[model samples]
Target: MKRTSSLAIRTASAALTALLALSATACGGSGAPKSRSGGPVWAEGQGATEAVGFMRVQTPAGAAEMKGAVQHGFQDTTYLLSFAASTGDAEAFVADLRPEEALRANIPRDSTTYTTITPWSHLGLPEPETQQKVRTASVCPPCIKDERRSAVQSITIFVQDIGDGRARVYLKAF
Candidate 1:
């Protein structure tokens, strides 16, 4: 009887230990989706780190025409940009972007202009390979500091390559 009781107690204690461990692990695990206001939210493994080309504006001389139309009180022109990265570098690219807090803190005191970011797409172009190559993406519209002034910046990104463990980021700004 003594031996049996001891064995029963040991068994129960072991079961309780296992249950506690499992509960703790489950409570500490990550299982929920992440999101940010209206901006794009990056997952754990979005974008690459291989330094795709930088984002910049296209020269006016190169433009086929004077691009831009009135939108939200400003004449915004579409810019062309490009990026290239290895199939696995997408996560790093997205991580390198400025976070929401950083952007808010960096807003220029005199630069009261607001910009909206959205993905740009046109006919014949395939969607960004966020899940496979690009990892993450977003868009930002160029706005003027004052309604009376013309646009002071361009807004457009063009992805052109994703090979040789590198990437390119081109911008077409007017």
Candidate 2:
């Protein structure tokens, strides 16, 4: 009787081990894949082509040196991009980005709760504390439709004229 009981216990233990191994394999291990678990990162000197790939706007042909950052959460990716264009291009640049259209640089979007979580400090772009003398254009997806709306569900853009014919572009999309 004792021998029979010991054999049954060993068989049960073997069966349990096999079950656990199979379970792990089917669940793809105990952790999230590397792609989904990546952390936030910043990249500088992004060209017009690369910057446009991440956002909905087409920077001017003469857009200057650009900066970009990406924060990858487990479920979504937040993209931040900054560049400078001639003040003349600011109007057309914000033409399509209308949801938050006409935002002023004086407000400092980074300090606001309604604006993007990505900060201007990260992009090395300063937020001037001037009044609404110069209009800033802000736009987004679905709020204002466009062909560029295909890839992303959310976007917010701000083009501020910082004087001297230079306008700064701050963009966030996911």
Off by over 4 Å in 2: 1-49, 104-106, 109-117, 127-138
In angstroms, the error of model 1 at 30 is 53
lDDT of 2 at 67: 70
In candidate 2 the C-alpha lDDT for residue 30 amounts to: 65
Stretches > 4 Å off in candidate 1? 1-76, 83-125, 129-131, 137-161, 168-174
- The alpha-carbon lDDT assigned to residue 27 of candidate 1 equals 63
Question: Model 2: what TM-score?
Answer: 0.56
lDDT of 2 by residue, 33-86 (tens): 334334554445443445468675676777786777766554676777777788
Q: How accurate is candidate 1 locally (lDDT)?
A: 0.34
**lDDT digits (tens) for residues 1-174 of candidate 1:** 999999999999999998877776676644333433333322232122211112222222222222221112123333333344442343343333322221111112222233333232321233333312332333332232322213433323333344665444333333
Candidate 2, clashing residue pairs? Answer: 97-139, 98-139
- lDDT score, candidate 2: 0.62
The 10-residue segment with the lowest total lDDT in model 2:
127-136
